[model samples]
Target: FNDGRIQQLAPPEDLYERPENGFVAQFIGENNTLEGTVETIGEGNCTVRLGDGSVIDALPVNVSRAGERTLLSIRPERAEFNLDRLPEGTHTVKAEVLEFIYMGDIFRVRLRIAGNENFVIKCRNAVGQRRLRPGEVIDVGWLPQDCRALEAA
Candidate 1:
Protein backbone atom coordinates (compact mmCIF):
# COMPACT_ATOMS: atom_id res chain seq x y z
CA PHE A 1 0.00 0.00 0.00
CA ASN A 2 3.03 2.27 0.39
CA ASP A 3 4.53 1.95 -3.11
CA GLY A 4 4.27 4.74 -5.69
CA ARG A 5 6.13 7.81 -6.90
CA ILE A 6 5.29 9.69 -3.68
CA GLN A 7 5.87 6.59 -1.60
CA GLN A 8 9.23 5.99 -3.37
CA LEU A 9 10.36 9.54 -2.66
CA ALA A 10 9.45 8.91 0.98
CA PRO A 11 10.00 5.29 1.91
CA PRO A 12 7.38 3.70 4.20
CA GLU A 13 9.53 4.35 7.25
CA ASP A 14 10.24 7.94 6.32
CA LEU A 15 6.65 8.48 5.14
CA TYR A 16 5.20 7.68 8.55
CA GLU A 17 8.09 9.40 10.32
CA ARG A 18 7.70 12.53 8.18
CA PRO A 19 4.94 12.40 5.59
CA GLU A 20 5.23 14.43 2.41
CA ASN A 21 1.49 15.12 2.30
CA GLY A 22 -1.61 14.75 4.47
CA PHE A 23 -3.06 11.87 2.46
CA VAL A 24 0.22 9.93 2.47
CA ALA A 25 0.57 10.40 6.22
CA GLN A 26 -2.98 9.37 7.15
CA PHE A 27 -3.12 6.47 4.72
CA ILE A 28 -0.03 5.06 6.44
CA GLY A 29 -1.92 4.84 9.78
CA GLU A 30 -2.80 8.25 11.19
CA ASN A 31 -5.86 8.78 13.42
CA ASN A 32 -7.67 11.89 14.60
CA THR A 33 -8.56 12.98 11.07
CA LEU A 34 -10.63 16.14 10.52
CA GLU A 35 -11.52 18.72 7.80
CA GLY A 36 -10.36 22.27 7.47
CA THR A 37 -9.65 25.18 5.07
CA VAL A 38 -6.43 26.45 3.50
CA GLU A 39 -5.65 29.73 5.11
CA THR A 40 -2.36 30.26 3.37
CA ILE A 41 0.50 28.46 1.64
CA GLY A 42 4.26 28.70 1.94
CA GLU A 43 7.31 27.35 0.15
CA GLY A 44 7.20 23.94 1.86
CA ASN A 45 4.20 24.27 4.14
CA CYS A 46 0.64 25.56 4.24
CA THR A 47 -1.61 26.84 6.98
CA VAL A 48 -4.95 25.05 7.27
CA ARG A 49 -7.56 26.90 9.22
CA LEU A 50 -9.76 24.31 10.88
CA GLY A 51 -13.50 24.56 11.28
CA ASP A 52 -13.02 25.69 14.86
CA GLY A 53 -10.71 28.48 13.67
CA SER A 54 -7.45 26.77 14.61
CA VAL A 55 -4.63 27.10 12.06
CA ILE A 56 -2.45 24.07 11.28
CA ASP A 57 0.85 24.24 9.41
CA ALA A 58 1.41 21.21 7.23
CA LEU A 59 3.20 20.05 4.09
CA PRO A 60 1.81 21.61 0.94
CA VAL A 61 -1.07 19.69 -0.63
CA ASN A 62 -3.78 20.35 -3.20
CA VAL A 63 -6.56 22.10 -1.35
CA SER A 64 -9.89 22.43 -3.17
CA ARG A 65 -9.86 26.19 -3.20
CA ALA A 66 -8.46 29.16 -1.32
CA GLY A 67 -11.46 29.18 1.01
CA GLU A 68 -12.79 25.69 0.40
CA ARG A 69 -12.99 23.29 3.33
CA THR A 70 -10.47 20.48 3.63
CA LEU A 71 -9.94 17.37 5.69
CA LEU A 72 -7.31 17.26 8.46
CA SER A 73 -5.83 13.87 9.32
CA ILE A 74 -3.63 13.03 12.33
CA ARG A 75 -2.13 9.89 13.82
CA PRO A 76 -3.10 9.07 17.38
CA GLU A 77 0.40 7.81 18.15
CA ARG A 78 1.68 11.28 17.30
CA ALA A 79 -0.73 12.68 19.88
CA GLU A 80 0.46 13.44 23.40
CA PHE A 81 -1.38 11.41 26.04
CA ASN A 82 -2.07 12.93 29.44
CA LEU A 83 -5.06 12.58 31.72
CA ASP A 84 -4.53 15.94 33.34
CA ARG A 85 -2.88 17.82 30.49
CA LEU A 86 -4.56 18.84 27.23
CA PRO A 87 -2.84 20.15 24.13
CA GLU A 88 -3.74 23.53 22.67
CA GLY A 89 -5.64 23.34 19.39
CA THR A 90 -9.07 23.61 17.78
CA HIS A 91 -9.80 19.88 17.40
CA THR A 92 -9.89 18.39 20.89
CA VAL A 93 -12.18 15.53 21.86
CA LYS A 94 -12.69 13.56 25.06
CA ALA A 95 -12.73 9.85 24.39
CA GLU A 96 -13.59 6.90 26.58
CA VAL A 97 -11.52 3.75 26.51
CA LEU A 98 -13.85 1.12 25.05
CA GLU A 99 -11.37 -1.72 24.75
CA PHE A 100 -7.68 -2.58 24.67
CA ILE A 101 -6.72 -5.72 22.83
CA TYR A 102 -3.26 -7.24 22.47
CA MET A 103 -2.61 -8.11 18.84
CA GLY A 104 0.85 -9.62 18.97
CA ASP A 105 3.41 -6.82 18.64
CA ILE A 106 0.85 -4.03 18.79
CA PHE A 107 -1.79 -3.00 21.28
CA ARG A 108 -5.03 -1.91 19.69
CA VAL A 109 -6.83 0.71 21.73
CA ARG A 110 -10.39 1.33 20.71
CA LEU A 111 -11.93 4.58 21.85
CA ARG A 112 -15.28 6.30 21.43
CA ILE A 113 -15.06 10.02 20.84
CA ALA A 114 -18.04 12.27 21.65
CA GLY A 115 -20.03 9.06 22.07
CA ASN A 116 -20.59 9.07 18.34
CA GLU A 117 -17.29 8.43 16.57
CA ASN A 118 -15.03 5.47 17.13
CA PHE A 119 -11.24 5.76 16.86
CA VAL A 120 -8.50 3.16 17.08
CA ILE A 121 -4.96 3.90 18.19
CA LYS A 122 -2.09 1.48 17.74
CA CYS A 123 0.77 1.39 20.21
CA ARG A 124 3.75 -0.89 20.63
CA ASN A 125 3.30 -3.75 23.07
CA ALA A 126 6.56 -2.69 24.71
CA VAL A 127 4.61 0.14 26.37
CA GLY A 128 3.34 -2.60 28.68
CA GLN A 129 -0.26 -1.88 27.81
CA ARG A 130 -2.46 0.80 29.32
CA ARG A 131 -4.13 0.42 32.68
CA LEU A 132 -7.12 2.57 31.78
CA ARG A 133 -10.36 0.60 31.98
CA PRO A 134 -13.44 0.70 29.83
CA GLY A 135 -15.42 3.90 30.30
CA GLU A 136 -12.34 5.64 31.75
CA VAL A 137 -12.11 9.22 30.56
CA ILE A 138 -8.90 10.22 28.80
CA ASP A 139 -7.62 13.35 27.11
CA VAL A 140 -6.53 13.22 23.44
CA GLY A 141 -4.53 15.89 21.69
CA TRP A 142 -3.22 16.66 18.19
CA LEU A 143 -0.83 19.41 17.13
CA PRO A 144 -1.58 21.70 14.22
CA GLN A 145 1.46 20.60 12.26
CA ASP A 146 0.65 17.03 13.05
CA CYS A 147 -2.65 17.53 11.18
CA ARG A 148 -3.03 17.87 7.41
CA ALA A 149 -5.47 19.49 4.98
CA LEU A 150 -7.03 17.04 2.54
CA GLU A 151 -9.28 17.46 -0.46
CA ALA A 152 -12.94 17.85 0.40
CA ALA A 153 -15.20 14.88 -0.14
Candidate 2:
Protein backbone atom coordinates (compact mmCIF):
# COMPACT_ATOMS: atom_id res chain seq x y z
CA PHE A 1 0.00 0.00 0.00
CA ASN A 2 2.95 2.30 0.48
CA ASP A 3 4.22 2.29 -3.09
CA GLY A 4 1.12 1.13 -4.97
CA ARG A 5 2.94 -2.01 -6.10
CA ILE A 6 1.36 -5.44 -5.67
CA GLN A 7 3.41 -8.29 -7.09
CA GLN A 8 4.51 -11.63 -5.54
CA LEU A 9 8.10 -11.02 -4.54
CA ALA A 10 10.49 -11.27 -1.58
CA PRO A 11 11.67 -7.79 -0.76
CA PRO A 12 14.95 -7.11 0.97
CA GLU A 13 15.34 -6.09 4.64
CA ASP A 14 14.25 -2.52 3.91
CA LEU A 15 11.21 -3.60 1.92
CA TYR A 16 10.27 -6.56 4.13
CA GLU A 17 10.28 -4.43 7.27
CA ARG A 18 7.56 -2.33 5.61
CA PRO A 19 5.06 -4.86 4.36
CA GLU A 20 2.48 -4.29 1.63
CA ASN A 21 -0.54 -5.62 3.56
CA GLY A 22 -1.90 -7.26 6.72
CA PHE A 23 -1.12 -10.68 5.21
CA VAL A 24 2.59 -10.04 5.79
CA ALA A 25 1.88 -8.81 9.31
CA GLN A 26 -0.08 -12.00 10.22
CA PHE A 27 2.72 -14.11 8.77
CA ILE A 28 5.06 -12.23 11.08
CA GLY A 29 2.84 -12.96 14.14
CA GLU A 30 1.80 -9.40 14.92
CA ASN A 31 -1.57 -10.19 16.56
CA ASN A 32 -2.33 -7.74 19.38
CA THR A 33 -4.47 -4.92 18.02
CA LEU A 34 -5.00 -1.23 18.68
CA GLU A 35 -7.21 1.34 16.96
CA GLY A 36 -5.47 4.24 15.30
CA THR A 37 -5.67 6.80 12.53
CA VAL A 38 -2.97 7.59 10.03
CA GLU A 39 -1.23 10.88 10.60
CA THR A 40 1.86 10.91 8.43
CA ILE A 41 3.99 8.57 6.31
CA GLY A 42 7.73 8.51 5.79
CA GLU A 43 10.34 6.52 3.96
CA GLY A 44 10.56 3.65 6.47
CA ASN A 45 8.11 4.69 9.16
CA CYS A 46 4.78 6.35 9.81
CA THR A 47 2.99 8.11 12.62
CA VAL A 48 -0.41 6.92 13.81
CA ARG A 49 -2.76 8.76 16.12
CA LEU A 50 -4.33 6.16 18.42
CA GLY A 51 -7.88 6.33 19.68
CA ASP A 52 -6.55 6.94 23.20
CA GLY A 53 -4.95 10.11 21.79
CA SER A 54 -1.51 8.56 21.93
CA VAL A 55 0.69 9.03 18.89
CA ILE A 56 2.29 5.75 17.76
CA ASP A 57 5.38 5.79 15.59
CA ALA A 58 5.52 2.53 13.64
CA LEU A 59 7.17 1.04 10.61
CA PRO A 60 5.58 2.12 7.36
CA VAL A 61 2.75 -0.29 6.52
CA ASN A 62 0.36 -0.65 3.61
CA VAL A 63 -2.71 0.56 5.47
CA SER A 64 -2.83 3.84 3.60
CA ARG A 65 -6.13 2.81 2.04
CA ALA A 66 -7.67 2.30 5.48
CA GLY A 67 -9.79 5.30 6.38
CA GLU A 68 -10.05 7.03 9.72
CA ARG A 69 -9.88 3.93 11.91
CA THR A 70 -7.20 1.22 11.68
CA LEU A 71 -6.22 -1.81 13.74
CA LEU A 72 -2.64 -2.22 14.87
CA SER A 73 -1.36 -5.74 15.55
CA ILE A 74 1.49 -6.62 17.88
CA ARG A 75 3.39 -9.81 18.70
CA PRO A 76 3.70 -11.34 22.18
CA GLU A 77 7.48 -11.72 22.33
CA ARG A 78 7.83 -8.03 21.66
CA ALA A 79 5.98 -7.43 24.95
CA GLU A 80 7.83 -6.99 28.25
CA PHE A 81 7.11 -8.26 31.73
CA ASN A 82 6.50 -5.54 34.32
CA LEU A 83 6.38 -7.04 37.81
CA ASP A 84 6.50 -4.06 40.13
CA ARG A 85 4.42 -1.53 38.23
CA LEU A 86 3.33 -0.71 34.71
CA PRO A 87 5.85 1.18 32.65
CA GLU A 88 5.15 4.53 31.01
CA GLY A 89 4.55 4.81 27.23
CA THR A 90 3.79 1.08 27.11
CA HIS A 91 0.75 -1.13 26.69
CA THR A 92 -0.27 -2.92 29.87
CA VAL A 93 -2.50 -5.99 30.08
CA LYS A 94 -3.53 -8.28 32.92
CA ALA A 95 -3.18 -12.01 32.46
CA GLU A 96 -3.89 -15.05 34.64
CA VAL A 97 -1.11 -17.52 35.17
CA LEU A 98 -2.54 -20.75 33.80
CA GLU A 99 0.46 -23.03 34.21
CA PHE A 100 4.11 -22.87 35.14
CA ILE A 101 5.99 -25.90 33.85
CA TYR A 102 9.66 -26.67 34.20
CA MET A 103 11.12 -27.61 30.84
CA GLY A 104 14.71 -28.35 31.98
CA ASP A 105 16.43 -25.32 30.48
CA ILE A 106 13.68 -22.80 31.15
CA PHE A 107 10.39 -22.34 32.94
CA ARG A 108 7.45 -21.99 30.57
CA VAL A 109 4.62 -19.88 31.95
CA ARG A 110 1.26 -20.05 30.20
CA LEU A 111 -0.82 -16.91 30.57
CA ARG A 112 -4.38 -16.25 29.44
CA ILE A 113 -5.60 -12.76 28.64
CA ALA A 114 -9.26 -11.80 29.09
CA GLY A 115 -10.00 -15.53 29.43
CA ASN A 116 -9.27 -16.00 25.75
CA GLU A 117 -5.94 -14.96 24.27
CA ASN A 118 -3.12 -17.20 25.47
CA PHE A 119 0.58 -16.41 25.56
CA VAL A 120 3.61 -18.33 26.81
CA ILE A 121 6.75 -16.76 28.18
CA LYS A 122 10.06 -18.53 28.79
CA CYS A 123 12.19 -17.63 31.76
CA ARG A 124 15.46 -19.12 32.89
CA ASN A 125 14.94 -21.34 35.92
CA ALA A 126 17.50 -20.55 38.59
CA VAL A 127 19.14 -23.54 40.15
CA GLY A 128 17.60 -22.92 43.59
CA GLN A 129 14.93 -20.38 42.89
CA ARG A 130 11.30 -20.90 43.80
CA ARG A 131 8.96 -21.84 40.99
CA LEU A 132 6.12 -19.63 39.86
CA ARG A 133 2.82 -21.13 40.93
CA PRO A 134 -0.28 -21.24 38.77
CA GLY A 135 -3.22 -18.90 39.42
CA GLU A 136 -0.93 -15.98 40.08
CA VAL A 137 -1.42 -12.45 38.80
CA ILE A 138 1.26 -11.27 36.41
CA ASP A 139 1.52 -7.81 34.88
CA VAL A 140 2.70 -7.63 31.30
CA GLY A 141 3.87 -4.61 29.34
CA TRP A 142 4.78 -3.96 25.73
CA LEU A 143 6.39 -0.95 24.16
CA PRO A 144 4.37 0.78 21.46
CA GLN A 145 7.47 0.95 19.34
CA ASP A 146 7.84 -2.82 19.58
CA CYS A 147 4.28 -3.37 18.33
CA ARG A 148 3.47 -3.82 14.67
CA ALA A 149 0.47 -1.90 13.27
CA LEU A 150 -0.62 -3.76 10.19
CA GLU A 151 -3.69 -3.58 7.97
CA ALA A 152 -6.31 -6.22 8.67
CA ALA A 153 -7.84 -8.39 5.98
Candidate 3:
Protein backbone atom coordinates (compact mmCIF):
# COMPACT_ATOMS: atom_id res chain seq x y z
CA PHE A 1 0.00 0.00 0.00
CA ASN A 2 1.13 3.51 -0.82
CA ASP A 3 0.24 6.45 1.41
CA GLY A 4 -2.24 4.28 3.33
CA ARG A 5 -4.13 3.23 0.20
CA ILE A 6 -4.27 -0.26 -1.19
CA GLN A 7 -2.23 -0.50 -4.35
CA GLN A 8 -2.62 -4.16 -5.16
CA LEU A 9 -3.79 -7.38 -3.56
CA ALA A 10 -2.80 -10.73 -4.98
CA PRO A 11 -0.93 -13.94 -4.29
CA PRO A 12 2.81 -13.74 -3.65
CA GLU A 13 3.67 -15.13 -7.07
CA ASP A 14 1.21 -12.83 -8.79
CA LEU A 15 2.54 -9.81 -6.95
CA TYR A 16 6.06 -10.47 -8.16
CA GLU A 17 5.18 -11.68 -11.63
CA ARG A 18 2.66 -8.92 -12.36
CA PRO A 19 2.75 -5.65 -10.50
CA GLU A 20 -0.03 -3.18 -11.09
CA ASN A 21 2.11 -0.03 -11.02
CA GLY A 22 5.49 1.42 -10.28
CA PHE A 23 4.95 1.32 -6.56
CA VAL A 24 4.13 -2.35 -6.47
CA ALA A 25 6.93 -3.17 -8.84
CA GLN A 26 9.51 -1.51 -6.63
CA PHE A 27 8.08 -2.62 -3.30
CA ILE A 28 8.09 -6.30 -4.18
CA GLY A 29 11.73 -7.03 -4.96
CA GLU A 30 15.00 -5.80 -6.39
CA ASN A 31 14.28 -4.18 -9.76
CA ASN A 32 16.27 -2.23 -12.31
CA THR A 33 14.16 0.77 -13.29
CA LEU A 34 14.97 2.61 -16.50
CA GLU A 35 13.31 5.91 -17.30
CA GLY A 36 12.26 6.27 -20.90
CA THR A 37 9.58 7.48 -23.27
CA VAL A 38 7.32 5.24 -25.28
CA GLU A 39 8.23 5.50 -28.94
CA THR A 40 5.75 3.07 -30.45
CA ILE A 41 3.08 0.78 -29.18
CA GLY A 42 2.53 -2.70 -30.57
CA GLU A 43 0.51 -5.75 -29.71
CA GLY A 44 1.54 -6.82 -26.18
CA ASN A 45 4.72 -4.77 -26.48
CA CYS A 46 6.14 -1.28 -27.07
CA THR A 47 9.44 0.36 -27.87
CA VAL A 48 10.96 2.72 -25.34
CA ARG A 49 13.38 5.51 -26.15
CA LEU A 50 15.89 5.71 -23.35
CA GLY A 51 17.90 8.69 -22.27
CA ASP A 52 20.82 7.57 -24.40
CA GLY A 53 18.51 7.67 -27.45
CA SER A 54 18.46 3.90 -27.70
CA VAL A 55 15.23 2.06 -28.35
CA ILE A 56 14.26 -1.17 -26.56
CA ASP A 57 11.24 -3.39 -26.76
CA ALA A 58 9.26 -3.90 -23.58
CA LEU A 59 5.93 -5.26 -22.42
CA PRO A 60 3.45 -2.50 -21.69
CA VAL A 61 2.12 -3.11 -18.24
CA ASN A 62 0.96 0.33 -17.15
CA VAL A 63 1.91 2.42 -20.16
CA SER A 64 -0.69 3.21 -22.81
CA ARG A 65 0.25 4.97 -26.06
CA ALA A 66 3.25 6.50 -27.68
CA GLY A 67 4.91 9.60 -26.14
CA GLU A 68 4.02 8.47 -22.65
CA ARG A 69 6.77 8.37 -20.05
CA THR A 70 7.41 4.99 -18.53
CA LEU A 71 9.69 3.22 -16.10
CA LEU A 72 10.90 -0.08 -17.47
CA SER A 73 11.23 -2.65 -14.70
CA ILE A 74 13.46 -5.69 -15.10
CA ARG A 75 14.72 -8.20 -12.62
CA PRO A 76 18.48 -8.58 -12.43
CA GLU A 77 18.29 -12.34 -12.64
CA ARG A 78 16.08 -12.19 -15.67
CA ALA A 79 18.68 -10.30 -17.69
CA GLU A 80 21.12 -12.31 -19.74
CA PHE A 81 24.55 -11.35 -20.98
CA ASN A 82 24.86 -14.29 -23.35
CA LEU A 83 23.08 -13.61 -26.60
CA ASP A 84 22.90 -17.32 -27.36
CA ARG A 85 20.84 -17.90 -24.24
CA LEU A 86 18.37 -15.15 -25.07
CA PRO A 87 15.47 -15.86 -27.37
CA GLU A 88 15.37 -14.52 -30.90
CA GLY A 89 14.17 -10.93 -31.50
CA THR A 90 15.44 -9.72 -28.13
CA HIS A 91 16.75 -6.17 -28.20
CA THR A 92 20.19 -5.77 -26.66
CA VAL A 93 21.73 -2.78 -24.87
CA LYS A 94 25.34 -2.07 -24.16
CA ALA A 95 26.35 -2.35 -20.53
CA GLU A 96 29.65 -1.61 -18.89
CA VAL A 97 30.60 -3.82 -16.03
CA LEU A 98 31.27 -1.67 -13.02
CA GLU A 99 31.79 -4.31 -10.35
CA PHE A 100 31.57 -8.02 -9.96
CA ILE A 101 30.96 -9.74 -6.63
CA TYR A 102 31.10 -13.46 -6.24
CA MET A 103 28.45 -14.53 -3.81
CA GLY A 104 28.13 -18.11 -2.53
CA ASP A 105 25.77 -19.36 -5.21
CA ILE A 106 25.38 -16.30 -7.41
CA PHE A 107 27.59 -13.62 -8.85
CA ARG A 108 26.35 -10.06 -8.47
CA VAL A 109 27.35 -7.97 -11.44
CA ARG A 110 26.89 -4.23 -11.28
CA LEU A 111 26.61 -2.54 -14.64
CA ARG A 112 26.01 0.83 -16.22
CA ILE A 113 23.39 0.99 -18.94
CA ALA A 114 21.40 3.80 -20.50
CA GLY A 115 23.03 6.25 -18.06
CA ASN A 116 21.94 4.25 -15.02
CA GLU A 117 25.07 3.32 -13.15
CA ASN A 118 23.29 1.31 -10.50
CA PHE A 119 21.91 -1.27 -12.88
CA VAL A 120 22.73 -4.83 -11.84
CA ILE A 121 22.53 -8.36 -13.23
CA LYS A 122 22.78 -11.59 -11.28
CA CYS A 123 24.42 -14.66 -12.72
CA ARG A 124 24.29 -18.02 -11.08
CA ASN A 125 27.56 -19.63 -10.12
CA ALA A 126 27.63 -22.57 -12.46
CA VAL A 127 29.80 -24.31 -14.95
CA GLY A 128 30.45 -22.58 -18.27
CA GLN A 129 29.50 -19.19 -16.77
CA ARG A 130 31.75 -16.39 -17.89
CA ARG A 131 33.44 -14.17 -15.34
CA LEU A 132 32.92 -10.45 -15.78
CA ARG A 133 35.55 -7.84 -15.04
CA PRO A 134 35.39 -4.16 -14.27
CA GLY A 135 35.58 -1.85 -17.27
CA GLU A 136 34.48 -4.65 -19.58
CA VAL A 137 31.73 -3.85 -22.03
CA ILE A 138 29.07 -6.39 -22.89
CA ASP A 139 25.66 -6.66 -24.46
CA VAL A 140 22.71 -7.41 -22.23
CA GLY A 141 19.37 -8.69 -23.46
CA TRP A 142 16.11 -9.84 -22.03
CA LEU A 143 12.78 -11.00 -23.39
CA PRO A 144 10.20 -8.28 -23.95
CA GLN A 145 7.77 -10.02 -21.67
CA ASP A 146 10.35 -10.04 -18.91
CA CYS A 147 10.57 -6.26 -19.06
CA ARG A 148 7.48 -4.47 -17.78
CA ALA A 149 6.81 -0.91 -18.87
CA LEU A 150 5.17 0.81 -15.92
CA GLU A 151 3.97 4.33 -15.29
CA ALA A 152 6.69 6.83 -14.52
CA ALA A 153 7.07 7.39 -10.79
Q: What TM-score does each of the candidates earn?
A: 0.56, 0.52, 0.97
The digit string of per-residue lDDT tens for model 2 on 1-153 reads 325655335655423344445555545433455567767766655667765465666654555633445556555445446433335655465667888888898776777754444566666666654566788876665554555556644
lDDT, candidate 2, equals 0.58
lDDT of 1 by residue, 1-153 (tens): 445444436666877765545556667655566566787776656777655454556555556456766666667675544523334453455667898777888776778654434566666666534655777877665555665566665
Show model 2 residue runs off by greater than 4 Å: 1-22, 26-72, 83-87, 126-131
| Model 3 / residue 112 / CA error / Å | 0.4
Scored against the true structure, residue 150 in model 1 reaches a CA lDDT of 62
Best-first order by lDDT? 3, 1, 2
Model 3 C-alpha lDDT per residue in residues 1-153, reported as the tens digit of each score:
889999999998878888878898888888898999999998898999999887899999888999999999998989999899987878999999999999989999999999999998999999999999999999999999889999997
Q: What RMSD does each model have against the real structure?
A: 5.1, 6.2, 0.8
Model 2 residue 113 distance off true place after TM-score fit, in angstroms: 2.1
Question: What's the lDDT for candidate 3?
Answer: 0.92
**Candidate models: Cα lDDT each:** 0.61, 0.58, 0.92
Tell me the TM-score of model 2: 0.52
Task: Spell out the clash pairs found in candidate 1.
Answer: 31-75, 34-72, 35-71, 36-70
